[model samples]
Target: MLPNQSFVWTGATPGVRYRFAILADAGNFLPDQCSTRWGSTDFGSRGLPGSPGFSGVPTRNNANGINVSWNDYNASYGVQHWRLYRSASAANRCSDTHIATLPRSTRSFLDSSAAFNTDYYYTFIASDLNGVNGPCSSNSAAGFRPGQAPTVSAISVSPATVVAAGTTVNLGVSATGAIPSNTVAYQWRAAGQVVGGSSPSYSFVGQGNHGTKQYDVLVSHPESAFSVTRSQNITVCRADQIVSNNACVCPGTLQEIGGQCACPPPLVRVDNQCLAPTPTPTATPLPNSFPQIINQPQSQSVQEGQSVTFGVVAAGNPVPNYQWFRDNLNPVGGNDPQYSFVAALSDNGARFKVRVSNSVGSVDSNEVILTVQSAPRPLRPVLECVMANNDGTLTAFFGYENQNIAAVTIPAGTNSGGDANLVNGGSILPGTQQPIDFSPGRVRGAFGVVFSAQGSAAYTLGYRGTGIVTETANSQSTPCAPIEPRLACVNPEGAGFRARFTYSNQNAFNVIIPSGPNNRFSPAPEYRDQPINFLAALGQSDHFEVVSSSGGDLTWILANLSATASGNSTPCSLPPVCNAGGPYRVQQGQNQVTLNASGSFDPEGLPLIYAWSTTCPGASIAGTLSPLATLNLVGNRQTCAVNLA
Candidate 1:
């Protein structure tokens, strides 16, 4: 039969037994070639009972296995019994085993044979008195019994003990005992505020007031909903301050004399202070004298793209002329004591000095080095959209644009240690769902964090390097564009290897990248069957694969961002499939429509089960448990949407 067409069987008598079968090939339907293996067999003509629905959330308990409950099948169809099938792999439903056969009234089952830390799928089916089984439940319920919770062995900080202010410190935690296949998430917090991302190592710059700061890293995994925290104390002192008597204190010359910062010789203490010795009188100055250099320029360190300046003070007769020199040879500044310019990467480790001269003589200032560190590319956080919930709360969907060719991790925090912070009324809120590890390029609606405030409350997002970006929880924002190429999955294909790549375009219009520097693969023959045109906001691509030799890594370059994949790269984990076709509309007087979700598929070639639900009032759904369902509206002018899972 053609797609969406049904076969009809006519003329059935009461109390008469009937059977039907469908054969794939004509040879299988021939009298001499008939075989049950060719297609279906042993189906009864009498209608089967409605499929039972899973009632409550399935729970897995240690040693006792998984417990599952479901609603009873329709009794009017003359129920016989219920069968529970279990499968270890969602992609292989044909391998499911009949684990239990229960009485007609039974609605619960305990599968004691399940293994811990492993996901299992379960479905229930009913059999009629005629001995024919009804359809299995539309969707399978998954259950996983978690193993041991994660443990933190120790937390370590580099610099070992103390760090100078304006210095970067590295903190890391060693953790173990998480579920075998689950990834552990890390959150580093300082003084109870999250300061790091989901990485085991955290980079913290010691800024602001100097003191002993407390930091903790929380390690967790979703498998068990369990977490453990380990903490470390870091001591920091400012540039002008010294660690004396276990405390940060200013030098005695600046005032405080206790705590090991004693005054030097020739300075006598009087009235809780150190007084400099009296100055001796000197002779009168000559008409022409050598220039005396003072206030020599200090060394400077700054990130790339930042500005730096060097200045020298001098005392001389006839007002000494000044000139600045770079690297002791090249004249780089005008005839002024101050030299200032924007720093570049090439200026790192270069030295600067000033020559003060008059008619009599010239004095050169001490040379100082300028250290220029390469700054990380800035990541711009974009607030894509806001959603108002039925419960009066608001949810803000956020995404980001990473200018780097590689991924960037921005920790969670407020005004420190992170790439961005979300603040409401001066109080920082933890962005639990915000993506800390940002993939390169633009990603729209990556994650959302909720807000409880209502009615036009503006939330501010403070991103490092980018000033405060404010948006109301109810504001509508435009989405950003095109995605970076990524290595989706890799698998061994015969003698060679196959690597799949994918990209996302958040723009409403398609984007095209002509194969060249912007879109090409590395190591020659740049166009490796990759697509040049990308669909707009279509989630992920159906995906394109590249076959390569068994050895080297194959990299896909798109818009200057590159992603490499090899045979050894991690395989992709496909998520469950749910595709409800159409924003289907009907005329004002039309009350019924059919919804189809037959186009949904699993990338790993898994069998899919569909469950339909709707949120319209006074409406009833028929075939609610199947991939194809019908929605009937009870009144005119009613609007609704159906969801498939």
Candidate 2:
């Protein structure tokens, strides 16, 4: 192909040779001098040959020689790299022959190396590392162009079937057909009810009254048709109460007694219904005293030194005033609900009478005999105690702590007269300790006191002076030991109490003493802080009892005595003490304020006793005094308010 007139192989390869030629015109005309041979001496030197020929390398070199060569087309099965070549015409076409080597990674190449808009033939052949070329591959035509459309796919709804009355359902739509994002929209409907627009899914509450309770969802996209509507049925109904058996009471209406609407007992029918018994008149045996007084037909026998408490029951209009009498005199001072004889003796005759009075009339209780005999004096007497003395007789009838004689199961304190003493234990005051015996006291008149002392002289003492057994003062030679006294004082407001004290006469000379100490008081009894002490000088060997001047004042009582002087022997008047009424007060309609100087007996503070006396009839006793006690009145209004005494 190098303008040579003869066939000559340039490179060495067995069984392989190449020839070059060009078809000037397709199956037709050939140009003049198209078959001219170079280096053949056929056309004389330097003269123009009638045809183009191969030149330079193998045969004689010549100008104006064009040659075209066609190598055996090599078909490469797996080769990715290929080169393309094309020729224009015969001998001089060697100069026009061009080769374009595809990139090593390229599998195809276009013949742009040739002139544009011209029919340039191309062949693709593979090259190997050994420089051995393979046969040319079949030629394929191509031109630059643009790309294709996208795809869309998966579409779904979460909780496809949901219960009615739920808010919203989520539709998860997925697609991969084409332009999925821009193409998708959703439409939803329930039964035949259409929801506007489109989403993956839609939810709606069932219109129970309007239509069938069902829903469906439709998903759509731009690329393709919308998906079929997904549907679900939800059950919905109004809430209703079901009654099965005997006429169930109409919702909240009250049913008749024995008609599936019976109420608890002691409760009477009210308002065409049964309700808790409203506050009503519960007669408390007229006297309003508990542990109902069991009247004895005649006198009862009591051993000496055994205190007996007696109660008498009498009923009348406007409540009765009671006076427990011994020898026609009121025993134990006031004629209140309770009467106590600390210790009995032979002198106590068998006759005791209680007189009751009311607004309408008065009645004399049957003479109850209490015959006293000589016996060992008890350590203490029966003391009926309450935390805050206020009237609770009627109101607390059903309360656990109410004074119900039948329910008074346990005696508070032990009494030698009531039971056998264990280990010769001494008597105890009421409210101080529990009685050891299981047998409850008769409670007809008195509740037994517990015995708590261990010593032989251990004694239960109640200050009630009407006891048959008389109090004997120790001889002057024997020198009775001093006892801390209880005092009562009157305050401008009500009653107060003071604790008794005997001043220490340590200096052996008359010296003025300023009470004892400034004991700070605690309103709440839980935290008992240390008593505040004050300086008060006292003379030695002086016998003076502390006295409270004011009425109804609370004062500290001496718990223990420690005098500076040795064997300080002095006897003073005993401290006077009083018991408080109950804590709650019964009023006509308004709240009440109860004042008590009970337990205000402090000799060093005040001597007089202060007690609250009210116009209310139900006012009972509280065992101690306080700063003030108030009761909020309840129940129906009353014109004639009962006085509390």
Candidate 3:
């Protein structure tokens, strides 16, 4: 039994406290499987019945039934099923029973059967198949035995100024009453005539009604004598005045649209007057020159998993090619404004500076030191059953975010929900669509999307609101999540050290490494930080980053002390040697002489590339430095040439 009304033990919605799962015979075992213990949101509550709606005001609708309201946040996502709890008396409020079972998306209820002078309390919870019972808050509303009529605070109008013909203005009324807001009706009057509007606001267009008009709004209730009236007046032009707009005839130039004056093409409005358009300036090409650094790199301290971006503003003759140096030594690649990546511990103390080079000489930027703090230990990836949002493909879905509470948690085990599987560190590319199914509910739906090619990539969660649901938006899942953005950050160290990041000036969010470096270090080795893919390096340069472009500077702090490297490089070996020829004999040539020079050797047995040259001017040699060579003599006496080193 719930606090309000007894929850009928029905077949479809049977469990008081239920257990649900989606584990298969294969993917995940029971021990590792995740299951959620869910709760519900509170329904509407009525305070003491005899109390007046407003403290000092008497409600004329004391005979009317009570009106109850609650938030419909779950319906916006995927959760639509709702259970309403009602208590007959204040004493029973904490022990209300589930009195009503509402379908998905139901938001409000009216209890005309509620007895007058009886204080009733209401609470509610929403759920789909895969989801657990929503949060059930115990809040305490009351229908009055109608007393005095409702009160009219004020009725007013915007723009009391005189209006041109056919101009629309707004009329608004404020009211307070014991009568439920939903039961109130509004009647707007214009010049003592009735208009067709039931809302608190009315749009009244003035079409020159003899220079002046009167308007009033009446607030009324159905079950009570509660009522109020207020009135206001406005001046309207008898007719719209014609304005001249010829460019040659008018001062400057003007055009008219919908009884308003506008400057024509080639003319623009300046202050209250129209004037000739200002000429736009064309940009001139900048001359090429050597690289000069404008904005230098700055030092940072940050938690691991966060990304950092090292940027530089430079001027150069040719667009400069950027080379980022680590420890003022190793080279990272780029020519753009920034470099970004996840931060690793190895990046700590790793100094970063950029050297921009073009046709002109290169200039190095100031080195920024990196400090990495230990990342907060990561909570296990959590999956949960949730009401579907319009961005999903199915009616029901298991959530994929990292929330730990019953409202947002994951299922334990190899529970497959449509397109969602238990893949570690899964990837969703830009523009790629994935399928999601709410488990237990097993509702199938999909959201096919092409992610944007630019900007950092991320996965975000929605707390609750008018999100997508399977029943309402069964097949049409919106690919867009609300712009609750995530960060892309990194540590300067290669990896292994945990890192985290969040904007200091904004609401805090979970720290995430959206991606590795946008571009890696050049002679910089590939970086791996996860435990298994580790590799030991002697003297290598690499890049790790934390995103700084998203409005904040990245700071990496040294939270834990790890080992630092000392000696690097192997001992030098013997250099290779080369000999010209081994016992070469040249034949006395009739027209030419052939020399045998096949034997050239190196002490280190290194493969040698051969080059041959001669100081003799008249004699010609064929295939110089070849195993065999033929020399032709132009003169009777010529010097023989044979050289190799």
Q: How displaced is residue 175 in candidate 3, in Å?
A: 16
TM-score of each: 0.26, 0.17, 0.25
Q: lDDT of each model, Cα atoms only?
A: 0.69, 0.36, 0.46
Count clashing pairs, candidate 2.
112
Judged by TM-score relative to the true structure, which candidate is superior, 1 or 3? 1
Q: RMSDs, each prediction?
A: 43.3, 31.4, 36.1
Task: List model 2 lDDT by residue over 159-215, tens digit each.
Answer: 433322232445444434432345466665756678646655444443323222455
Q: Residue 176 deviation, candidate 3, in Å?
A: 20
For lDDT, candidate 1 versus 3, the one ahead is 1
How far residue 360's Cα lies from its native spot in candidate 1, in Å, is 20
**Ten-residue region with minimum lDDT total, candidate 2:** 391-400
lDDT of 3 by residue, 395-450 (tens): 11222332222223333223333211232222342222343222232122122112
Question: Which candidate ranks first by TM-score, i.e. highest?
Answer: 1
Clash number for each model: 0, 112, 111
Top candidate on lDDT is 1
Q: Candidate 3: which stretches are off by over 4 Å?
A: 1-186, 189-262, 269-273, 278-286, 327-333, 376-645
Candidate 2 regions exceeding 4 Å error are 1-185, 192-198, 205-213, 219-227, 235-645
